[model samples]
Target chain A: QQQVKQSPQSLIVQKGGISIINCAYENTAFDYFPWYQQFPGKGPALLIAIRPDVSEKKEGRFTISFNKSAKQFSLHIMDSQPGDSATYFCAASSEAAGNKLTFGGGTRVLVKP
Target chain B: DTEVTQTPKHLVMGMTNKKSLKCEQHMGHRAMYWYKQKAKKPPELMFVYSYEKLSINESVPSRFSPECPNSSLLNLHLHALQPEDSALYLCASSQDHWTYSGNTIYFGEGSWLTVV
Candidate 1:
């Protein structure tokens, strides 16, 4: 069973637009949520992360809106650029579960110039 | 350096061949993980090592053996693998194990493996 589920298998946005990707997880024990950005033939790099304590966290153009009560979180890329095109993955992990990261079905985002 | 280095970025082997994938991290992380990823799919956990000791083995097959020589090194031995086992092998690490918050796992540039 997939504990974490992500929506919109893929999305395309115009430059300077907003790209939003959402994910919902079933496990309530999950307290840590992170988003990773991966390009072709490269490793997934940590983009942004948010804990349940905060409702939202923003870093540069990347923002993570987390809803602990809803068991959901979303990633928003502001002013999307063609260089920002890549696969974005949402992951959840609980310290109780050995901190093993559970990843959602990735969302491929493409920004057109 | 906050990096996990994996060797042999790409490897192609026959069914009867034996090979190994090496990973090294210098971030003083105590937890290391091995994740297998297929094309266009999320990575699947295979093994976890904490403080240079085996912690979790996701019931992986015996054909895949994992080793932790030291705190900063991890190795995966592949032998007599089937074609279906071919995928990108990723190595990851974190500061510590069993931490609820603020634990960010860093990943290495995966090693692509092909079995014929």
Candidate 2:
């Protein structure tokens, strides 16, 4: 069974606009949520991560909003730029599971300047 | 270097041939991982090594073998791979694999492999 589900296989946004991506998980055992960014022919890099205790976390232009009760989370990019275009993946992990992460399919974002 | 390095950025091998993909990290991380990703899909974990010991094997096929010769190095040996096995191989490392909180992982540029 797929542990994490992400919506909008692809997205497009104009410069300075906000780009949003949403994800949901069925495994309540997951307590850690992280987002990763990857470019063409490159490996994924962690962008920002949040624990289940927090409702939201933000770093620079990236923000992650999480709802514990709903077992869902979303990523929001403010003032999106052209360079922010890439594939974004939402992943989850738990200490009980040896920190093995289960990832979402992915969302390709295109920012137009 | 502070980043993970993977050798042979691209490789193409025959079905009967044998090849190895190498990865190295100098970040003093004791936990290393091997992940495979296909086009338009997320990475799938294949193996995990903690403190130079094999910790997790995600039911990977017998044709794929992973080794951690040392804390700073990890290798994947491929034999008789099928065309469906062609994908991007990614290597990652983090601090000791004990704590999940405050644990950050770093990934290499990844090696693209094509099995003919």
Candidate 3:
């Protein structure tokens, strides 16, 4: 199946806390996984990405943890702030599909101050 | 610049009206895409163009026509669209679709289309 399933349709966290969003893909061919952040009335922007070869990739407060064997990946936001409140989407792409990204259901995060 | 610019940020057109959404990028990208997004939903792929040629259509309806006039320009012509078709239309571009390293697609602000 060419599908990506995401969990926690929505999340609520406090400032300085960590926000986590999980996703699982059924396609084994997917080699590129990326996370996108989108605000209201704006297009989704590329936040972070990882290849299956690495187990973890971190950039500042944004980190991506990948589990190749389980076909699962997650995004963690450390020291979450109110500005981090937005919709996050997990997407997977494969060379076979011309690198077309298959996005999962978005997770709406609300970081309370 | 790493930006994809779209025109007519907001549009309100009747079902019988004909309008087009334009997108441009000077990032020297060769792969462009058109995606449709409904409220609270992920963007759905509508079409893909590579090297100024149409590559994928995703079985999109004919009323939604996509054109890639050049390597830096893409357009979506809309006609006879229903009210349910009202949503955000996003334009994205990548360096190339054949290579994985250059597949980081960047999206434009998107055009908010309203069908009346």
Candidate 4:
């Protein structure tokens, strides 16, 4: 079963514009949600994360808006740049899973300059 | 360092050949994981190790074996594989086994395995 689902298989954004990706989950046991960015030939790196307790969390230009009751979350990148072009993935995990993340299919983002 | 290092960034093996992928981390993480990813697909969880003990196995095939020799080391053993098994093998580590606070999962560069 796919616990986490993401939309927009690919996204194109102009430089300095906002880029957004959305995701949803089915398991209520999941309490931790994280977003990862991956470049070609590299590993997925943690970008930002949010807990169910908070509705939103911002780190630099990246923000994660989470809804516990709706079981949904999204990542927003402000002032998008060409360097930000990469694949993004959203993942979730429960406390009992020992941080074993269930990931979304991934969204390829292209920030055009 | 906060990096997870993987050996042999690329590997090409035959279906009958046996090979091993190694992962090492220096962040003193107590939990480690192995995931398989196809092109344009999200990573699929294969195994999880906590405190050098096997904690979760996702009903993976026997052809894929995971070993945690220590807190910082993880290994994936492959044997008698098919061409369809070729994919990127990723290793990740987390600070603790119980992740109620969204512990970050640091990943390695990934090992690209091509089975012929």
Candidate 5:
């Protein structure tokens, strides 16, 4: 079962623009939401995360807007740069699962300079 | 440095061969995980270990076995794997899962496996 779904399998944005990716989950049990960034030939790394308690989080130019009641969340890259080009995955995990994350298919983002 | 280290960055093996992928982390984390990722696909969980003990097996096939010898080491044993098993094997570690505290999972470079 695909517990989480991501949209726009691929995205292309110009530099200095906003790159947004959306995701939704069917399992309400998911309490922790995180975004991961993966470059070619490398492992995925945690980019940013948010819990249900908050609606938004910002770290540098990366931001996560979450809606608990809607079971949806999104990642927004402000002033997107070529360096921000990479595949982004949104994942969720619940306490019951013991930290086993359910990841979204992923959104490939390319920031054209 | 906080990192998960994996060995044999790349491997090409026969279907009948026996091989092992090793991972180690030194971030004082008690939870570790093994995930498989195919081209253009998100990672899928295979095994998880908490406090050096097996905690979760995502119904993975018996051909793949996970062993956590100690708190800092985790290994995945491969035996008679089919060509479909070829994928990137990723190892990750995070804080104790019981806390319910949001812990960031860290991943290693991953071991690329090609089963023939």
Candidate 6:
């Protein structure tokens, strides 16, 4: 069973536009949510993350909005640039699960200048 | 180096051959992990080690074996593998195995393995 589901397998956006990706999780026990960005031929790097206690967390151009009751979360990149194009993955894990993350299918984003 | 390093960026072997993938980290993290990822798909957890001991195995097949000789090194031994096992193998490490609030995991570039 896919515990975490992500939508929009791929996306294209114009420079300076807002890029959005959505994800949902079925496991209510998951208390930690993190987003990772991966470039070609490289490992994934942690982006912004948010917990269920917070509704939103933003770091520079990246923003993660989470809904605890809905069990849904979304990532929004404002003023997207060409260099921001990469694969994004949403992951979740609980403290009791030894921090073993369950990841989403991932979304590839392309930004055009 | 504050990074997870994996050796042998790529490898190709026959079904009967035995090969091993190596990973190292020097960040003093106590938790290590192995994950396999297919093209355009999310990574699947294979193994986890904490404090130089095997913690989670994910019920992986017997053909794929993972070993953590020490706290800083992790090895995955492949023997009698099938074509379906060809994929990108990633290694990751974090500060602790039970904390999720402030733990941030770092991953290696990954080793691409292909079985002929």
Q: Write the per-residue lDDT of candidate 1 for residues A1-113, one digit (tens) a residue.
A: 99999988899999999999999999998888989999988888889998899999999999999988889999999999999999999999886886788999999999999
Error of 1 at B4 (Å): 0.8
lDDT tens per residue, model 3, A2-107: 4999989999999999999999999899999999999998999999999999999999999999999999999999999999999999999987887699999999
Which pairs of residues collide in candidate 2? none
Error of 3 at A61 (Å): 0.5
Q: Give each model a TM-score.
A: 0.97, 0.97, 0.97, 0.96, 0.97, 0.97
| Alpha-carbon local distance difference test for all models | 0.92, 0.93, 0.94, 0.92, 0.92, 0.92
lDDT of 2 by residue, A72-99 (tens): 9999999999999999999998888766
Better of 3 and 4 by DockQ: 4
lDDT over C-alpha atoms for residue B85 of model 4:
97
Tens-digit lDDT string for candidate 4 (B58-91): 9999999999988989999999999999999999
Candidate 6's docking class is medium
Range of the 10 consecutive residues with the lowest summed lDDT in candidate 2 chain B: B96-105
**Candidate 6 Cα errors over 4 Å, as ranges:** B100-102
In candidate 3, list every pair of residues with a backbone clash: none
- Model 5, runs deviating above 4 Å: none
Q: Could you tell me how far off, in angstroms, the CA of residue B95 lies in candidate 6 after the best superposition?
A: 0.7
CAPRI level of candidate 4: medium
DockQ of each model vs. true complex: 0.72, 0.68, 0.69, 0.72, 0.69, 0.72
Candidate 4 docking DockQ: 0.72
Q: Could you give candidate 2's per-residue lDDT for residues B1-116 as a string of tens digits?
A: 22999988999999999999999998899999999999999999999999899899999999999999999999999999999999999999989676764477788999999998
lDDT of model 2 at residue B78?
Answer: 96
Question: A50, model 5: CA deviation in Å?
Answer: 0.4
